[model samples]
Target: MFLVYVDESGDTGLVNSPSNYFCLSAIVVHESHWQTTLNSVIGFRKELRASYGFKLREEIHCSHFIHKPGDFQRIPKSLRLRLLRDVIDFQASLLNYQIVNMVVNKKNKSLNSDIFSLAWQTLIQRIENTLYHHNFIGSNNATDSALLFVDKTDEIKLRNLTRRMRRYNPVPNSFNLGSGYRMMPTQWVIEDAIHRDSAHSYFI
Candidate 1:
């Protein structure tokens, strides 16, 4: 089994929104490596605590940290930038993990466009494709399944979207004779996405 953790950046709103893009990112880790990955993360957090006075339980919200909002105001801007770079480096060093990201440019989209749903659909489709082709870790050729853990945002909407996709996901068949799409219902992802508060989940 694979454990997928998902999070989003930027608001879904288009009008008067500060950012023009909304992004969804997922980190995939095999069940066998979950514990090791968690341990590594905890170790990294501990190092942060010891070296920079960053609390272990403190959630690392990039925007808030960068903007020096609330408690983050106490930390130096230069140190925050360094910490962000450390995070990227640590993530890069992790083994048996894959990161998938989907960004929606809302510049061309209508104000009424459902940015959240569109971004999630594209992100989930990419994740499903990755699972289909490379489900297993290492030399194991047997296919594996995955469960998604998304940061709690729009639970009802996201759940409905995931459930619907599992039933009737269609993808364009580029190799077909004409403009055609094929049914590719999600088979490897099990059940609806389990929502978790990002505050509690360090991975989120």
Candidate 2:
């Protein structure tokens, strides 16, 4: 079995809200099927763009379809709905997957540490623990490996926000989630496109 950990950027609450709560989540998908699911997502979006003269709204981060500074929700209803549908279709297309969500309250660390860090750690810790309980995943000789997909961070453009991520704890072995109370080294993949769309991207 393969583990694909996911993370997100941007405030989880209503867009433009003053709060500093960004949503961070981690999910696991079968390695054997990860590439297939990813390719499907790429294909779906490409098809939509070719079929429709206009681009979808949720692709807000997409350079081809970015919203003005003050307008994020002003996107057309049809485009927005399509975006949602695409996410749903992505999960349906996946062979199998499991998701874990972590909401970071960046405003005050009093209640919790950084959410981004927590999200990453949680996935590591949780996955490791799960494995310890279930023995090695694939085979007797199989070594533990995990990949994390992180959405690209904006340094110059969104420097302040990306800077916040710098606060996240850097672990030498962030590959495996905490396994059976023991920390093991595993591969971690950090893909920039992994974000709020991830939950939707890999939903059950």
Candidate 3:
């Protein structure tokens, strides 16, 4: 079995979003390595507290780290930079993982209003390729399945869009992740979207 962790940066709102780009990123990993990866992350958190006297309960948020807010305000700039670097290194150390990222340029005034759907479509296609080629679970096995985990904020809307696309051919005769042409229905994607706190969300 494979687990897909997904997260997005930037707001989907047309008018309120301060940023010009919206990015969606996903990390796919096999079940066997999940515990190792989770432990590595937990270890990193503990190391920060033990070595730097940082708060163990606090999450390392980029905005808070960079801006040095509240408890972070007392951290030295050098230490903050090092923390960021170590976090990046930890992410790079994951083995047998595939990353799928989509960046939407919202500068164009004529861009589609449903930019979120567009980004999701691209990500799903890449995910489909990973599922088809990677036979870690087994070749054409009926039990082949992947679970998608995302933040709770968008669970309802994202699931609605995903199910709609899966049920109907929104883009007929075009590149898509549907099971129309494959034995394994892309519908293998679980409808029950799992959600977690941003702090615990490694994908974010």
Candidate 4:
């Protein structure tokens, strides 16, 4: 079975504000690989702490390192930059995994807005193709389930708008690991628990 996780970035309200440019990030992996991937990242973080005693999650006094606070800052800037460059250079050796990402340019407006849905459609079409063609995923399977980790900073706004579109509320911030779509707050302590398993699974 295929496990899909999603997340979103940027504000869901007015575009002229400081947090403009709404982005939705998603990372889907085969269920078979879920535990393997999560365990790997978790183990790596522990090694970092043991080897150098470098406090990874500075914000919280926790030991299980899947979603440690300040992990974005903790990871060496050089490594982050390298991935950006190596990823584009067709450097398979450097890529962490095969993934796809889509973003709604809120410079124009909210995703549910008429203008934004145009762009949103294209993003969905691409994702549909990716999921269909993935060998590990196997699209011919009659049943499919998708998960979403939406950044509802504009909870009141997005929920109302999306309900109008989907005819119901998408999902709430009840994160059941990879069992179902988790609508979570975009805070470190909360968002970090999802980092390694479905790190970019913010939106669908």
**Cα lDDT listed for each candidate:** 0.86, 0.49, 0.69, 0.42
- TM for every model, in the order presented, reads 0.92, 0.51, 0.79, 0.47
Select the stronger candidate by lDDT from 2 and 4. Answer: 2
Model 1 spans > 4 angstroms off = 135-141, 175-177
Ranking by lDDT: 1, 3, 2, 4
Clashing pairs in model 4, backbone N/Cα/C closer than 3 A: 5-201, 6-149, 6-201, 6-202, 6-203, 7-201, 7-202, 7-203, 67-192, 173-183
Which residue segments of model 4 deviate by more than 4 Å?
51-97, 108-125, 135-145, 149-204
Residue-wise C-alpha lDDT for candidate 2, range 53-114, written one tens digit per residue? 33433343432333342343545656755755665676565555666666666665554344
lDDT string for model 4 (43-122, tens) is 55565456445443532222223333355455565544443343245323322234556665556554457533433333
Give candidate 3 regions above 4 Å deviation: 109-112, 135-143, 169-185, 201-204
lDDT of 2 at 123: 51
The whole-model C-alpha lDDT of candidate 3 against the native structure comes to: 0.69
Off by over 4 Å in 2: 1-5, 11-17, 54-75, 105-116, 134-143, 153-204
Which wins on TM-score, candidate 1 or candidate 4? 1
- Whose TM-score is greatest here? 1
Cα displacement (angstroms), candidate 3, residue 100, comes to 2.0
**Sliding window of 10 residues with minimal summed lDDT for model 2:** 186-195
Give residue 31's error in model 3 in angstroms. Answer: 1.3
Compared with the true structure, model 2 gives a TM-score of: 0.51
Scored by lDDT, model 2 comes in at 0.49
Candidate 3 lDDT, 1-204, residue by residue in tens: 678888888866677679888788887776776787677767877888776667656767677778746778677877887887877887787566667788888777454478777777667656765666654432355455678788645666777766765665334333665444432335556555578776666554
In TM-score terms, candidate 1 sits at: 0.92
